[model samples]
Target chain A: MDTPHPGPDLHPHCTIVPPYLLVRLAKLDDPRFAQAAAAARESLLRDSQIRQLRGGEHPFTYSGARTLPARTPGESDRTISDAGGQERLPGRRVRAEGQPAGSDPAVNEAYDSLGATQALFWTQFGRDSIDGLGLPMDATVHYGKQYDNAFWDGERMVFGDGDGQVFNRFTISPSVIGHELTHGVTQFTANLQYEGQSGALNESISDVFGALVEQHTRGQSSAEASWLIGDGLFTDQVEGVALRSMKAPGTAYNDDVLGKDPQPGSMADYIETDDDNGGVHLNSGIPNRAFYLVADALGGNAWERPGRIWYNTLTGTGLGRESDFAAFAAATAATAAQLHGIGGAAHNAVLQAWVTVGVMTGRE
Target chain B: MKVIVSRSGGMAGIRLTWEVRVEEQPDPATWADFLNSLPWDDVTDSEAAPDRFAYRIRCAPHEVVLGETQVNGPWRDLVNRVRAANGM
Candidate 1:
């Protein structure tokens, strides 16, 4: 709680200066290095007190102003850290790439889940990592005290331990991990504005590939896959199977405390609201159901053609930052035609799925 | 004062809401002071982080939606105060 006042410059070298060195610098009695000492203290305070927002959510869609980190061009480079019940991020590195499994279940689960997501991208779409050039996939677990959420803070994934009353530990589900990691992928690519349809699309994209990651890992066919985004996250006390069900959007849960799942399966039922960033989480069910239909129709492995279409459309230059359901559907259809031929099964499936989901009227 | 605290937009995509009447609390003056002490006009309207817990805290004419990162310092104190008052 002893947060020091930030220095004039705001400590640009906080990352380079180790915490121990920063601590020593912060306590040094030198007047000349007062700014340096204050900067160190500010950095330390950031680590101690604040939950780093990082770029403050990039108010506008990326217009190529922000360049992602350079690629490593190999296997996934990962680092898992522990927040130790604090709101700080990347708290302390507990597991790194190629390290043996740690004793903490959350740490190991995070490590494995990240690897699975990386493997799905690489093995299926030739994507190297979240950014496709092998950007490191890192995560932080056990963040905050009984924290009930997991988020991608533009740079890395941060997970809460969950309240345990309604939700279990977040790391218990691989799909949740995949969902968070995909946000990084979205950030690097479409950079969808996190509001309204675009925000819902942002949420839906994460859920689509998220479920795919788990299915790819289980080697389950489309029918075998649960199509639920947070499968094991709910405690038995909560009357829910998962957070969002792609197969049946609003049917994921109906509880007294959590209330009925407010998601709509089609444009006919799309919710219009200002909360949750224009109901990004609620209206996402429309696209989510669309993706599910495509996967179900394709029938062997959902991540193959269906996954390729979604992934390509996301990474491809067809989408705008503010792409609506129709626009994204059109983009996906274009991708399907590009991947599979025009009038082909994959292309046809996408058309029918979008039309059925009311994302589009009909194929041109 | 009547205050509404609603959290939404996490990875779970769940929304939880609570309504608190400061007048009904043991100390109404402190609650008024607490609400006045917050920077209601300084809230950033954009999404702060993906899937991070955010709150829509409204007190009559003053209302703001804050991302988890913004819900620190005095913001955190206000939120915790509301939650504690609600017995959450």
Candidate 2:
């Protein structure tokens, strides 16, 4: 319900679903959802005013070519941070002394993701680190006790050791870290509100950049890359697949604990919800599938034309804090045309990707 | 009050907990009322001790079993407890 913006930006970001999801939840079968929705709406209204007052200040600063030296390795090897950026002590199972620094698979995964995300911005968009100022990267792996989620807490990224039944150590997956960090990147760039369809797009952008980072890191072509978030975070005990499959949105998980993966590959099947910051994770499947379509259509390395198109759009396009799927689609197409000539493969891929996702046809 | 809620049984395998102190001898009925009044359901059964009452709350995305006690009782109280005590 809190808009990412500070004030007067209540309708800060565009959402795939109407704000009516809160309205719907308010009328849900369960009294709790109704209460939760009512509370969320109140906060949303309050956040609207807050956003109005904090106009035009970037959450993350921009500083090209500035590099902050990494902190000297501290004796207290493990550190954790909360959603609001307050640091916490590490748990025993993930004690820094128990595992060698950067040697732990989780630590390595975090480092690699940070590197890849940083490089993508630097190489493709000329953007610095998460704050675009080369902010010393800070990531907390194994956050919370059996924390089942990973998130960017407006400052640093945090990973969770999944319950190991439905999910594995989030740090095992580079995309997960990249996805979280990209939220910081988004915070700096567009500051997209993490609610409704705009929030979904925000989530989708993280996924898109996440998959790109993985592909770039592995030197995998778009055709070769799995385009799966949390690919390595699923244990053998889990069901048929990884966290969220870009190639196949709804087929990620079907376990009893998490129910079915509620991702939709197309606009027609989009999920509308008020949970998880307006269902940012759930509705992301639509745009995730759209990116997959674009990457597949263009072929070769995704970080090539498709990546360029996206990176250009992300950095250059005047995407509003409230930009929606259609707005994003247009920007991508425009970026593709700008980079690879009008009606080029990149441009065509953008149109085709959106069309496959059942957005507007005949790019205007 | 300090309460520890450990969740070893569940599909998520996530163990999360937070402690709350009510500043008085915790009545089982009052504790039960607080638990029952929650907009959630408990996944595990619980019991009360001389110094504390414990409850296990199971929810996907977050799960924490908890114990509670009066603030100025025995025990130096942990840093987390101190934060909780100070209502941080």
Candidate 3:
């Protein structure tokens, strides 16, 4: 009931790939990965420029003028745009609701991913869309020339054709699409501050739903899931499985060019640094692992019990924008208790998961 | 004189740095002339967007940290020049 009302400056430029990974990519000297390096540099430059522009007065505001047609509970309205290898927002309208599949694979992928994400929220949670008000889902593909990342820019989802050498098209990953859209859900709900612990929680929530969408789409139980964030985003040339792994945090990638995956799965390995907004993407491994533990213990579809507990915590009144790991863990435990029972297996599992991840959840 | 430019903030919260030594440039006089025409001391910090970048420019004896909204005119010009010189 008490949703966050963040100031105008609180909205973050939520991107799927962390900057450290891109920085490592930009610093590579191998000739075979020269294109990847160039793309990384370009993405960094473009990201910096966008941040600068956003800081100015009268930052670009979302114009939610286009409304989707009224539909049944399970139906969705989706639109996919093509940026044509340029840096722009909501580019040329290439596909609309009920339109046949397009020629470009990227366009079709975006459309289908949006539908799948919508279906997950609607069918399982009884929520309509990102805003929980049947908002029209919009996306843009081929955003920039070899852009190395994807982002949710506070308005709509934007995907990029990654450097073919190290990364693939962002639209190719369903979990990634779900991850970006979940930022919208967070924006309208918890509105967590995008720095320090809260930022890490923000990132974790997206990863949670992202993994859930993938598992739901594939009809996989918790035991059958891979628990990877960006499984298909990487190319074969890179010696990596995915961008990040919920099952094994730091074991996702250890490539020479991309550097080691810096995620830490517990508080014992928590890194205190001024970089990466106080390690939002890095420290998120702790909570991610906690979720994985809960899902594994429950032994069924993750979106059923674990998903409900996490989602309730996120949208519940107990959450705050500045909530740290302990606070968030406490909230999840309380939500699990409220949803199940005071001393049920789900609540106990939630508490034990946090403790296993080195986060003390009993504190205030 | 030496100039070091650092950029911080953004979605990733990564900081990027670039430096230029005035004496090492091919046209030191030109560089000096460009630096002299700007009102570096009068510039003030401005409001920054959430998750946006701020810049810190240290020109020998003088240093200033300014948010992206504060960048304009000579400051923007100087940042662009330094970034281009460093091939960033």
Candidate 4:
């Protein structure tokens, strides 16, 4: 018997993880945290080297692999490809710039998301694309048979048809689009290594903006926002609301097989593990909570003052490849101070948020 | 031999594991041959891509970890069989 597909999740936004998880970097006097920093660095170097060594392996069939920013000051350049269930990438050109919606839901959804994400960076942050120079967004959908994951390969966004047991489809959630695309943005900007604390930061950065992309499109305030990542990716068989909750960490889901949400919103409960890049997805709960707190305190559209502070810190060049949670917290506080004056509402909100999350020791 | 397959580090950061006791399978010899066919020596556990599933396969004393892309051919064969045997 065939099951009726409920279709793609329309309003919900979800982003899964891709943390490097080497050493987690030392934080809050915890000497045990090497979380995957070294491995993360090694992997990043190896990935770049692989790119150089493994050229011509993927078929560059599409001409819009990168659409230039010459059309207008803020126009988006996008290309969507279909893998047709083979493992190869950038499979075949199915859609291009300014194409009408096709019968396939995955293609249409990806196209709309790319446009929305591009619009967020352009209108809100005055930035061009994933890169400020207006990098064209490229994505491949329907990759592999029941391939339950979506990832960014430092070049294009690759999405898969979920197994239909636990997940629906990668494109079901708009936040996932923002989340994966934000990984591109992070690579272009701070380029945080994906392991441990920095890895968690990498994941958190994507979630922060992933939610922002959703909120901006829906015009929802911080209070009105769901603050849940991967909200509707799970099937009815799984007992979960979303993948992770930014407002309340570790409260997103609880299932018999998937187990409970292992995310921790504070350092005291920080999970130290060798998997998930030293719990890059788990420990990210701390920073995600911090951002939510900041937005809650600011009491307006989160994309306005709160997002500006985050956007400035992200592009300010203050973050290093190995920057831990504390360093990132300090940078955001400084950015808030510089932008909204010391002891001002935004600055205080940043400090209080970090302190609450145990990233920073005090309200400094 | 007991084979365990643990999947972690995806977009959701959730982990699911399944295992099969090769000795208890209907065709133990065939399962062992398939398990032994995996390219274990070539797996370097350093490279991890963002938001991809990482698999840890442990068959007795020999253990190997592979990213999502590497789980094909013999590797995919081993994982799928294990999950099926375990009724996962």
Candidate 5:
């Protein structure tokens, strides 16, 4: 026997409902329930492999089926779908951009995040669009069967729509949308190598802005805002509070299925790994904590000073192609100095944030 | 043996790594030309050594770090192993 190739295994970075949850589902007395759960898990694995193999056909690869105004149109904020709509291609669906509100709030959340991110970049960054032109925001809600992760390909953001067993709908929260869109922003700006600490910084920037976008929209201060990313993505079964907690890193969630929140609260426990774009998602806890510190230190609105500093560093500074955590600290400090002043509170905050994370700036 | 061309840095700012098999050890000229033929303008030499680089080109059982200058013996053997593994 060919040692049975172990079939296919999940990629290190792949997101799915915890296998433990599936085991529970598999143990259910109801035959239909157990069978459905098993089928869902199988489908998720298959879909993840399909996504990896497809490699390029990420959802939202196209603009919406129809076009919206170049700027904000007077259209009401609503969700639209192409259910029963004809398929233009194998996976492509043909539906008007403004058909009707999606029944699921998660779907609407994805759309809202997309729209808000686009608007934020246009209004604040003055970038043309996703590509610095008017590249339409494309998103695929309910991507994989019960998939628990959301990601942005080079083109559009694809949401798993969640299996409802572990996660409800990815669209239930705006931060998830913001998180994915900020990946696009990083793509266009730093184009940070998606490996090692550089990759972690790439992820951290996304989380920083992901939360900021929601806060800005709601006009909530850093203290007032939950400062949690993907707050609504996880279901009640999950033991943790949120997906990732910026204010209190590492406390996002802790459960049997997903295990403990792998994120670190400070730099002392910063993780280092060679998998998943060099453990981009893992080490991001460092920068995520840094942003939280800066926000809290400054107090009041996070978008005002802390957000400006980080945004400037990401877009303005020449971040290293393979930057480590230390390089990022230097850049943020420099960015704050350039934006605020040498001894300005913003600059000091950047320096202090790194210290809290166990990394000092400039031989300090 | 198969030679994998895993380019790490380029103008598109993309760290694209892909592998293609080659039969015999190709002529250095042709191989160099093929590497040069990629879209290079979008990338400038950030560190000024070269526009882009293949940090690690793994040939199945072996691997090599292609530096800026002379191809070392270990690097050559690494390529040979890949070719042999691919049964070229």
Candidate 6:
């Protein structure tokens, strides 16, 4: 029997930090931030090269030299590798499934964060792994010389040690790990095109699940959660609480070297530009706030009701690769109404949340 | 001769710019020769990869946008020189 298959041909090089922020970091002339500047420039070059490799007409295919293990449902198999400051992936394997904690802090942190992310999906969404097929989760630490970003290259997650002056280890925040992994989930599900408003929605969906993973792990109510994306990723030297704030956009960071966060929380402040994949990271704040409002209005565990609505909309049939903010809002409201009764608290909450963020759900 | 290059696109979609006046260079003749040797006309417009960087070069009457991978030879050398001059 043929099983339901994931959609065709959409692979995005999803990264936790946007290139614009890195560009600012790269252009800093301050003596104190020189290392960060160099690292950011190197990351940009490497990222560009990787994108070129992945953007060919034919899909990337693996050779037959290596074989993957048989997938076991409901089991999580994780591997953490150490790159040893080289710009290579899945470097020397340092830790594996069922292995004891390693001596390296980065390795241990990556291992634990991967487990947390896996637990969140398994316990809440019934997703065994990124592909829901018990696909082995893998990560690499110490990716490059003072590398300042983390990314999911349509396969495994790669992280950098970061310039100690500006950023910390990518594995420091569990939500970041969840955020990157959710991209894999999206690749298998809606596979939203990573450009313009659709790209913003794609980013918002990851942030929503990323926040939920953190909240679920901490058992925090919607009111109690911080709603910050990369809360602890920034060093104390930077004048920032996190990379992006779901609760309040455009307020995550403001520093002499880092520049101000450009995220817009409402459609009124939406930016129109031809850069950063049409401002995916900047415009994501609108939908991020929408989800936050819905969770706040409903009260209680967000991953249960609000999270379910978002997840259903993501995996549901109506969601297309090019879905924009309005389309997503309507889908969520429809999902809420389907899960709950018409005009129920959940449905009204979803609609009101979208409207509060200046996005019409058209649920009337 | 005066040239301006604007680099945009990347994971974050931010834009960076650099401008150079050939006559103002410490060695004007050397800079002019360097600019003239570049294969500017050969840099064709191409589709950009999602979230990858692209560049726009505006040097007087000629203007062209090239994807990040298409930036090589003199294009890469010029961009690198500008970035180095800016202390990047």
For candidate 5 chain A, the 10 contiguous residues with the lowest summed lDDT are: A1-10
lDDT of 4 by residue, A1-364 (tens): 1121122211111111122211121121232323333334444445545435535121111112122223564678899999999879899989998988999999998999999998887787777677565567999999988988888888899999898998989898889899999988887667787889998999999999999999989999999999999878899999999899999999999999788999999998998887787788889999999999999999878888888788878776567667899999999999989988999999999999999988887835
Evaluated at residue B17, the lDDT of candidate 2 is 46
Instruction: List per-candidate RMSD values in Å.
Output: 11.2, 15.0, 13.8, 12.3, 20.1, 12.7
* Candidate 2 vs candidate 6, TM-score winner: 6
Judged by DockQ relative to the true structure, which candidate is superior, 5 or 6? 6
lDDT scores for all predictions? 0.82, 0.58, 0.77, 0.80, 0.59, 0.76
Where model 4 places Cα greater than 4 Å from the true spot, the runs are A1-69
- lDDT for model 4, on a 0 to 1 scale? 0.80
Off by over 4 Å in 2: A1-103, B1-32, B35-88
TM-scores for the candidates: 0.83, 0.64, 0.73, 0.84, 0.61, 0.76
Query: Scoring model 2 with DockQ, what do you get?
Result: 0.03
Compute fnat per model: 0.73, 0.00, 0.07, 0.64, 0.00, 0.18
lDDT of each residue in A259-296, candidate 2, tens digit only = 56777898898766533444566777888888888888
How much is the lDDT of residue A174 in candidate 4? Answer: 89
Q: In order, what DockQ does each candidate have? A: 0.56, 0.03, 0.08, 0.63, 0.01, 0.16
Docking class of 3: incorrect
Residue A324 of model 5, lDDT score: 75
For model 6 chain A, the run of ten residues with the poorest summed lDDT: A57-66
Scored on chain A only, each candidate's TM-score is: 0.81, 0.74, 0.80, 0.81, 0.73, 0.80
Off by over 4 Å in 3: A1-71, A361-364, B1-88
Stronger candidate by TM-score (3 vs 5): 3
Highest lDDT scorer = 1
Residue A74 CA displacement from its true place in model 1, Å? 3.6
List the TM values for chain B, per candidate: 0.90, 0.24, 0.91, 0.89, 0.34, 0.88
DockQ, candidate 5, comes to 0.01
By DockQ thresholds, what CAPRI class is model 1? medium
i-RMS, each model, one decimal: 1.0, 13.8, 4.7, 1.0, 11.9, 3.6
